[model samples]
Target: MKTLALLSAAALTTTLLATPAHAAVTQWGACLPGQGVDPRQECTTIEVPMDYSAPGGPSVTLAVSRIKTARPEVRRGVLLIIPGGPGSPGLNRPSTLVKKLPQEVLDRYDIIGFDPRGVGKSSPVSCGLAPADLSLTRLKPYPDADGGIAENAAWSRRIAEACARNGGPLIRHISTRNHARDIDRIRAALGEEKISYWGVSYGTYAGAVHATMFPATTDRVVLDSNDDPDPRKVSRQWLANYAVGVEDSFPDFGVWAAARDSDYGLGADAAAVRKTFLDLAARLDREPLAWPGAKPEQLLTGNLLRETLLNALYSTANYPMLAGLMKAALNRAELPMPNQPEEAALQNTAAHAGATMCNDIEWPNSIARHEQQVKRNRAVYPLTAGMPVNLGPCAYWPFKPAEQATRISSRGPANVLLIQNLRDPSTPYSGALKMREAFGQRARMVAVDSGGHGVYLANGNACGDRTVTDFLVTGHLPARDRNC
Candidate 1:
């Protein structure tokens, strides 16, 4: 999930709970069979109107699952795990991550997961993109040397058209606002007065919107790897932040590369390692190496490295891959292409991500503006090579935003906790700071001195994890900012 939207401190408690008239009326039953993890983890289908305004209009099914508390005596209520990827499904999370939680936490709450509309196990939407069209480099935003994006623009138009034709009506309604509404509907179905939430990446944005639209319903929230909720920019801002993120995390990779010089032999010093990478990328840009069995055998330097770097930034465990690639490229030796995600899986994921980004807010359609911005970004931040600020398929997407972006206010209860990495290559610290500022006194931020995406149980330091866990367990937070 991407970062969440903003919330205001309005006394929205009155709107938090379902009305008594609606409480007993559970339109969607307990979870259905063969959906997620344990059979005990119930799954159910909820039919929601395709268009919210026309409650009785064409409807689609939302797939949901829940694992009730293992210990009824300590059970508090439901804790929703919001998945990132505007289109990522939460359906199997309860079986996966929920089981990882400490026994005490599990004992206190029923864990819930769901596939948002147009996602897995729900009503899915696709752009029907060809396998070639799903390549990481191709899907990534890249600009031509002359700062021209004619190719990108054309590709975007093609992708948009495909989605328009194949996505059906569900594609148009994939914005964050609607997703929040869907969460609320799930809350109502669960028959809970309020819900605690753990939102990661894009999930944070969904949680924020839910809090803003129905603040009182948010019992406790943990927003990890936060993104700035700037309505005007949205994902554009996120992409731009990648440049800063790379600058921050590259040093960690540099250290690792330097340390392994004897084995991989990329460089003897950190500075040399950096130079070697940049040089290799520059050379690759001019003449790509042919990688056997790869989608595009001719590996363009920028894309190959960018994709590799993106994957590496997921966690320190991946640093070896980057190191090996760097070593192979340095010696002009053959390097294997990264394994591609399954075509159907990639399409589904990309379509979901695209729908969420496209529907979250409107993107500027001016090619001239995007071209100029890309040129400036390339000149200023060569590491990212202007991909961050370049135009996306959303620029040519067929749908308009369903609603204005929600503004986050700090007016809700002080129950929000944010955990962020200082040098995250995906979500940068600067952006997390923006989220912290937006939440103001209502949230406490624990900034970890780590170099990767994700926090909490993932890339988080012990101090950071403890902070979040303490809050989830005891509802206690530091009075102010704390650096880990």
Candidate 2:
């Protein structure tokens, strides 16, 4: 549901030649403030072609950052942190990683981070969409009252048109395939013979693409909360997977909420808690509530409430955010929603996400077909409703994908490691199995008996954390998949 930070430093790239070598130069310097900055972090930039097809054409700058290990004597190699999100910013991840990662792991390599092209300080692009269209509920594309998709269809067309008019040429080239290419460019600029990698959520897909494209150059690869790398579907499949993911994860929230029914009164037990959520969502659908700063057009509608639950499902620490809101809503009280990003940031995120997903693979162009999927998904997955299929971009996207989506192959090194929560609300376990299958014998999975989005160094599962930490530091994986 959220993208993790990877790097936050001043990464600026020099112009380069068109060959695959991408003969580029890197000059490291102090990072600008506020991209997960740490005093120890150094920032630089690398230039990668906007469109890999035309390497001689213009390039986009990628902000790269690193925290070199204090124990240079024991330094193993470069460990690149790939940020999550088709639209997530990088450059500040080294700062965040320094705090979360074990010192032993941090001491082994020059941990690197970078903003993908068309994101953050790296030649950002936007669709200039209206603030209303940028809201979480609208961006997720929930259907109108009575489950009709008329508004969703029209909004999709409208946003697609906005992106076409304002996104310029750079937006057209943003995709996982290009992200992998940019990573290789970073590798070349770093002068590394091989690089180890860590990518979470969407970063997992990006890292997979890198491993598939440049296998031999990759040393150790770790993918946490992975996406189903089904080449034919790619991001389109990810969009629809919400139905299954939410269904898998919501039960954990339900049990947790039910245990504290005395505090929030969400439900007396797990079954009751589930009922309360469904019923409350239905009631809100009929009549939305008001909130400060939501504007007249944006209120706490049923879909918005559903969005809140989806976000809260990511981590138990954030569960109180949802519980408080649900309590307030039921009591007719006011509560603030989390993460009200500025309109400009929202526009950029929407544009990048739309371009990356739409360009990754073709989506059904027929609005009627989308509506049909919405109807089917809504009935089966009441928690997420039909928002999973109620897309507002790909169906009306203005351009065909510049290149085919990357197929994550099993021919890569078996150094790949996957860590997942069985009940992830974003990248569900069923889908993770698909990614595991795609890699075949090339990967080992650590299925943690936890309930959260991120697993390694997150969620506080000692078994899961120790396994991944051992793998990263020692380069040894379990003989087979393990359960923690």
Off by over 4 Å in 1: 1-40, 145-147, 296-300
lDDT of 1 at 321: 72
Task: Give the Å shift of residue 293 in candidate 2.
Answer: 2.2
Task: Summarize candidate 1's per-residue lDDT along 1-484 as a digit string, tens digits.
Answer: 1111111011101111111212232443555444335666767666666677766566666677778887898788888998876556678788887656877788888888887777776777667888767766666776754456888888888888888898766778788888888888878878888889999888888888888888888888999988878878888888888888988888888888788888887777867877787777777777777666666324646566766776676678877877877777767787855655455656777777888888888888898898889888888877778888888889888778868888888888898988899989878889988888888888989999998878988888788888887888888888888899
lDDT of 2 by residue, 1-484 (tens): 3411111222232332344436555467888876448999999877678777777777777778899999998999888999777777767888888998898898998989887777777878788888777667777888875788888888899999999999888878888888888888888898888889999999999999999999989999999999999999898778788888889988888899999999999998878888888888898999888777664245777888888888788888878788888888888887655456556666667777888998888888777787788888888999988988875678888899878888889996789999999999889999999999889899999999988788888863899899889999999989999999
Stretches of candidate 2 exceeding 4 Å from the true structure: 1-26, 295-297
Residue 440 CA displacement from its true place in model 2, Å: 0.9
For candidate 1, the 10 contiguous residues with the lowest summed lDDT are 5-14
In order, candidate lDDTs are 0.76, 0.82
Worst 10 residues of 2 by lDDT: 3-12
- Count of backbone collisions in candidate 1: 21
